[model samples]
Target: MRARDLVTDFPTVALDTPVHEAARLLAAQRLPGLIVVDERGLPSTILPGTQVLRLAVPSYCQEDPALARVVDEEHADRFLRSLDGRTVREALPRKPRELPVTDPDATMLEIAALMARTHSPLVAVVDHGRLLGAVTLQVLLDQAVGT
Candidate 1:
């Protein structure tokens, strides 16, 4: 199968999308991550859901198990409130990384290899410079298992 054949509708967020809003969409859609598009509507980055959670939970909580237990949901939620003024760009990792992308004509193996190399949950299928859709890990696995 080609990457285009596995492509499915997926959410895309703008670089300026509010961090909190993006997190809500990620959770609501049950996605592992979101495709961050640039001003020209080209895929720019991948924002992993784990990164969102990392921002929501305090560093102290992550560093110490005991401190985490002391934090209630209400308190934990306060950390997320800090994301109000932040944009998706602000939430990106400090190190730059290429967004996982595949041509529409790419084979499934090529898509899977790219995903594995990038450690991304989904790979964007690009036709020229435009993003057509994404091939998610689940979809790749389903194809691999002949589902």
Candidate 2:
């Protein structure tokens, strides 16, 4: 299958998208990650769910896993409040990397290779610098396994 055939209408977020809103989108959709788009609506980066979770966690807990167990469930549940007033751009990794993007006509193998190499959950299918849609890892695996 080509990227065009595999592409689905996945969610996209802008740099200024609210962290709380983004987190809700991820949770509601149960997505592995979100594609961050630029002003021109081109894929800019992949914001993995783990990265969003990282924002909810306190640095102290991250530095010492043991500390997480000490916090009460009520307090722990409130961790997501840390994301309040933040934005997607602030949640992005400090280091920038190439976006996992593929051409609409690209072969499934090519798309798979790109995803594998980048360890990305989704691949943006662009046609001549314009955003088309995305091929998610789950969709790719389902096709491969004939499920």
Candidate 3:
């Protein structure tokens, strides 16, 4: 199947979307990541779930992971509060990774190859620069194993 055939409506977050809201969506939907769109509704970047977690963690904890272990469970639970007053744009890496995109006619192998090469769990399908939908890794895997 081609990208269009596999594409399914998926959640997307805008650059200005509240970080907490994005985190909620990720948790509620159990998504691997979210497609970040521009004001024009075009895919701009992909925000992996790990990046959101990274934003919640303190730099000190990241710098020295052992520091993370020292934090009591009660305080560690509050780590996500760090994302308060933050926007999705702020959660993004300073240098964005290449967006994994494909056209409607792209073959499954082409999509798989792109996913593998980019290490992205989602691929945005664009037609004439407009997002049609997305194909997630789970869907791709299900199709691959013929389950």
User: Considering only N, C-alpha and C atoms within 3 Å, which residue pairs clash in candidate 1?
Assistant: none
Shift in Å, residue 103, candidate 2: 0.7
Model 3 residue runs over 4 Å out of place are: none
Q: List, residue by residue over 38-118, the lDDT tens digit for candidate 1.
A: 998888988788888888777887889699887777876577787788899888999988779888899988988998899
State residue 67's C-alpha deviation in candidate 1, in Å. Answer: 1.6
Task: Give all TM-scores, in the order shown.
Answer: 0.92, 0.94, 0.94
Q: Each candidate: RMSD to true structure?
A: 1.5, 1.1, 1.2
- Rank list by lDDT: 3, 2, 1
Q: Candidate 1 has what TM-score?
A: 0.92
Enumerate residue pairs that collide in model 3: none
Clashing residue pair totals per candidate (backbone < 3 A): 0, 0, 0
Per-residue accuracy of model 2 over 1-147 as CA lDDT, tens digit each = 899999999889999999999999999999989999999999889888888999889999999999999999998889999899999999998988777998989888898899888888889999988888899999999998899
- Candidate 2 backbone collisions, by pair: none
Q: Write the per-residue lDDT of candidate 3 for residues 1-147, one digit (tens) a residue.
A: 899889999899999999999999999999989999998999999888988998999999999999999999999988988798999999888986778999999988999999998788889999997899899999998898997
Give per-residue lDDT, candidate 1, residue 74.
88
